[model samples]
Target: MREDTKYALITGASGDIGREIAIALAKQGFHLYLHYNRNEKAIALLQEELVLFGVDVIPIQADFTNSDAISRLQDSVFQLDVFVHAAGNSYYGLFQDMPDQEIANLWDIHVHFPMQLLQKWIPKLQRSDAGRIIFISSIWGEVGAAMEVAYSAVKGAQIAFCKALAQEIAASGTTVNVVSPGMVDTKMNHLFDEEEKTALLTDIPMHRFAKPSEVGEVVAFLASDRASYMTGQTMRLDGGWFMR
Candidate 1:
């Protein structure tokens, strides 16, 4: 890694949104630590794509839900200019049928892991001339979802966490914010059939699902110096889904 080159450590980098964010960051000459729990092949392919930019790209695997893994991550990455916590899991079921373990997993990934990473990297990130911490939340986190009760709870807490942490780190030159997306066209929502997709799309004022690359570009700008004054903000990338 070049001594002067800055780095962004993005969790869930194997997913569609994560992969696009990696490309966007690479285009801006940011070295990347693309973290994934599984999908070795996808990470390998992403590495091949990223190499075209001639930046340092390190693909790492760590289950963010595990406390031990979180500790190891803190040890490995001492400094990060951009920290994007995109690692998340979702369970779509009624609150009555939701098992205890599934509920725990939601909080582990969405709430605990993000705050843990932010806490661990506080000193290092503050040392940077400019640093940004972004949490990938969902519109469900904003208004709360019916079947996605656990997911919405955890994600909602993350939004609150971002606001509080943003204030704490403001004087230290670090920004903390959340990006709440709605109905992104990713594998996560592949389980939805054409009819279900159509129903969901109709609710969005834009009448379409968000492309992964669009979210990526938004993240890149938020992480850049151009957004220096933005902090503690829940920037809604939803296409007016919550409007209706």
Candidate 2:
């Protein structure tokens, strides 16, 4: 909120990676604008933890699928130094088996929300001395996954948005980039059995799945001045899962 200070707006802050990023950024003396769609309990505990770090943590709720909620959020946070669009959902099944509405839902959450947020944040960020915009995409976005057509499409859209936005914001000292993580160990994939997990690991050079904190650390780095020259690129933290 202060010009002499920095603030981070992290969406999907209730999730594993998002929560880790919130903690890491808080430790870095960042005022946090944490957004969560549901799970108030997790958000409450996270708010308490962030406050323990002696930083301001504001927990807000917004359904990425809703345009009205997003507009309200943009109005609430007039200016932000950093933004991480990490809220997304996926359904794993045959493309033909998935409902049409499911595909639309993924597009709204993964594609439309990030685009709209950037449309609102970019100008404000341009007014700042420096700013960072990070999009959490996936390896599937880079190389399409067989059963994740809609998810992959949305992720791919994010990647495209990052590249184009990077070029648009470069002259303004605002960086836009994408971070694509591969097969992260999150509750979303807890449905996998041991054999399924092992099967997924066998293809990866790093046999073990990546921890959420591992991805968060990279995000913190990018949000820092260290990545000043880095823009228009999608950095993959996939543990050798996708060589791209």
| Off by more than 4 A, model 2 | none
Give the range of the ten consecutive residues with the poorest summed lDDT in model 1. Answer: 235-244
User: Alpha-carbon error at 238 in model 2, in Å?
Assistant: 1.3
Tens-digit lDDT track for model 2 on 1-244?
5687888899999999899989888878889899999877899989887778898888899988788999988888866899998888889999999998898889988888778877877887788776999999999999999988889998999999889888877998889888899989999878789999999999989898989998888889888889988888898988898774
Q: Which model scores highest in lDDT? A: 1
TM-score, prediction 1? 0.97
Which residue pairs in model 1 clash with each other? Answer: none
RMSD of each: 1.3, 1.1
TM-score of each: 0.97, 0.97
Pairs in steric clash, model 2: none
